[model samples]
Target: MLLKYKYKLKPHKSQSVIISNWLEIARKQYNYRLAERLNWFEATRTPVNACPLNVSVVPVEGIYQNIPEFR
Candidate 1:
């Protein structure tokens, strides 16, 4: 099944830049982690299906936790 959702974002120019940078960082990190895991799996002759680095983030908390609480 396909899931769909929508929301509004009101980020300013600087905030948008920061968000873009963060997305790039996250992508690079995930790719590097996946590559390292794949190498290890190959060395041990393990199955490729064992990789979970590209899996879902069901237990993910808020990404902006450091932001101060709004009054």
Candidate 2:
């Protein structure tokens, strides 16, 4: 069997940490926004994602099953 791939990534320690932090922040922000949309819907009877500011989608099932933090 042969696997063929050609790619190079040379990230320094600081770069890696920055990327990790960004991902974590993004995930948390996404969840928080989703919660906000749900709250709006409950209070105002408007569906989440109905408005431009509330661009929320419930996480599709089984996506990102193995997040790094879980390890």
Q: Write down the TM-score for model 1.
A: 0.53
lDDT of each: 0.80, 0.78
Clash-forming residue pairs, model 1: none
Q: Report the number of backbone clashes for model 1.
A: 0
Model 1, which residues run further than 4 Å from truth? 1-6, 46-71
Q: Write the per-residue lDDT of candidate 1 for residues 27-63, one digit (tens) a residue.
A: 9999999999888766666366876565443435565
lDDT of 2 by residue, 1-71 (tens): 99999998788999999989999999999999999988976766555666654444545554666655543
- Which window of 10 residues has the lowest lDDT sum in candidate 1? 54-63
Estimate candidate 2's alpha-carbon lDDT, on a 0 to 1 scale: 0.78
TM-scores, one per candidate: 0.53, 0.47
Candidate 1 displacement at residue 17 in angstroms:
0.3
